[model samples]
Target: MELLQLQYFQVVARLEHMTEAARSLHVTQSSLSKTIQRLEEDLGVPLFDRRGRSLRLNTFGRTFLMRVNKALFELEQGRQEICDLSSPDRGSVELAVNTAGTLPAILKKFRGTQPFVHFHVQMLKVEEMHALLERGEVDFCLSSPPIRGDEIECQVMLLDSILVAVPITHPLCDKRSTTIAELKDETFVGLKRGYPTRDITDRICKSEGFVPKHVYEGDEPARLRALVEAEIGIAFVLESSTWGFREGKMKCIQIEQHDFVREIGLSWHKSRYLSKAAMAFRQIATDYFNS
Candidate 1:
């Protein structure tokens, strides 16, 4: 099959609607349908199942989509390498970060050191960052501990300890330090289920033999702090993340008992070759964190 056919199939598989896919590809619906039909006929397998106006990829299509996506990404990377070779100093780096705390220090240092290099940092979920890395949409990512998966290469950038954030007016505000057990009955604000910090929060609470009485679920640290400042609930966050807080509204107490330390790091696909610009930024990141 032609590369165009694979591109069309990939888009259709992603959108799951021939009409929408056609619109996105700037082609007529009939033409897109015929192209896919020809592709399926040539392969002797149905790629998609039509259900009313919607479409879904069949088992074969799912596998085919993965391969096609990888091929497209590699092709794009090859083109980028050529472009980067021609203008290494002017090339851009796309970096994704899941948390704001670890970003500021690195970004500050990067800006001071590599003022000529362009950076695009997308604040994504940890899982979303991993997906973008796999798709070759981003060159690298910064995320928390327990960096699983065989395809990714991770390096620790910094060590952070968990802290408890409470409204200044709250009773717990008087405490210099606290245990997870002390906060068991307190109304808690937490990151949403899949966040790296949420996993740590859950593990600490579970170890203490109590579940958090969660009142709010915020995915961003800033938003979680807002909820905590409103006296809605107490939140557990990395100590570095408390930099933006004002002393009047919130107080951050160290969680001495939980051993809730996390290592923030940079990750990229091990199989992918780093672009010159990405390599420069990675080195800059390494030095920035180490310093």
Candidate 2:
């Protein structure tokens, strides 16, 4: 079968609508239908069951679609590999992280070796990272509270403890360690509920029999730390996050009663393309954390 037929089939299987798939493929409905028919004839079984304007993958279609996806992914990766071999010094690496502030040192270290490499980094909520990886949209994802999926592989770079940051004037500032139980009633300044940090914080607090009262929930770390600096509320922050707040009266207290840890890791799809620059960046990221 032609590669175009396999590509069309993949898109049709995903959209499941003849008109939409045809539009997306920039081909006519009849042409698309004819392509599928030819593919089925070559395969000796119908791949989809037509339902008016929509199509559903039959049992055979489902099995064949999986293999088709893998084949397409590999072909795309091979095409990239051929293109990337010509330009080793100047390549782009697309990476996603749950938080932006966590990667400066690691990125700086990676850039040290590959000065010509460019980064296309995005700060995404952890929930969205897996989908980005699965679709091959990003070469790497530094996920926190690491994602679990058979389609991707993740390596734990570090286990960062979630610490409590409080204003010096607060009662717990002088304490060396505290518990979620002690801080249950305390209001928190953190990211919104969809973030891995927020989710982990809520889970840990729930284990202590209470939920956090978020005084503020926004995407920026500066806001979270600023709120704590103003004594507006305490924050559940990473141990590394407290470094910026350390210059002031903010105290980063360890959570002694619970592990209160987050697993930050490097993740990529099992089948996604990785250029030389991307692979180098990945190795540096892995080494930077492990060292």
Candidate 3:
């Protein structure tokens, strides 16, 4: 029933190991166990199925945990609201990003207007970003192929075309555009699976009846060109990425056969409280991308 008891239970439910949970909470194992026991007694039902030192949430615990998470999130929001009210000019904007291509420009523009407002940016997989959005953990998410749900509000900022990048010496460099089918036999340097560009390009290749044979698989978009330039392999890159490689060592060809444009969007959970600082970032990011 106590706030302390609920907090302890949340940690235990997540870790599922009493000793590990207690260590994380900086409390003794016996004390943490006693707290959970008291909470279960108060509710008149066992929350977790226990075996030795391991714990697993039963049906009742799973249902209660959802409510507990919401309660704690609201309490944390209340605290942030109070702080935001006191200093409207200074606060932090927490953001989860799916693609980092446009971040430099967006953050540079945002900081120009609200220099005092700090940013906490995390580059996450699409699923991880969705999880954070549902939990009200992030102020906003910059995503590709836009996150869609009844509880979320999303606005497309840009329609970025995906292009094929090749070294100047490559045979395909003579053409201004190429089809996905044409690239089937060519070795590619690609972003890892979780990346939006990688996912989109994979589907494009799948639709064309063959997987892209990757000479190298990496997480960094910046290295895609370098890999291609060294004849490691050609790559699928965003149109915006072409700007950095304009010296002529690499050529970015259009995908003429498929309209391979990815929609970049700004998304936020509708139920979460939007602080003034976070709102400012949203407006600035929207304007920057639109312009």
Query: Among these predicted structures, which one has the highest TM-score?
Result: 3
Sort order, lDDT high to low: 3, 2, 1
Q: TM-score for every candidate vs. truth?
A: 0.80, 0.82, 0.91
Please give the RMSD to the true structure for each candidate, in Å: 3.4, 3.2, 2.1
By descending TM-score, how would the candidates be arranged? 3, 2, 1
When 1 and 3 are scored with lDDT, the better candidate is 3
Candidate 3 lDDT by residue in tens digits, 131-156: 88887889899998787688889999
lDDT by residue for model 1 (102-151), tens: 56777777777667778898978777787777766777888776254678
lDDT of 2 at 225: 70
Candidate 2 Cα RMSD after full superposition onto the native fold (Å): 3.2
TM-score of candidate 2 relative to the true fold:
0.82
> What's the distance in Å from true for residue 92, model 3?
2.0
Q: Which pairs clash in model 1?
A: none
**Residue 144 lDDT (model 2):** 75
Off by over 4 Å in 3: 244-247
Estimate every model's Cα lDDT from 0 to 1.
0.82, 0.84, 0.88
| Regions of model 2 farther than 4 Å from truth | 17-38, 41-44, 90-92, 104-112, 115-119, 122-128, 131-138, 148-151, 247-249, 270-273
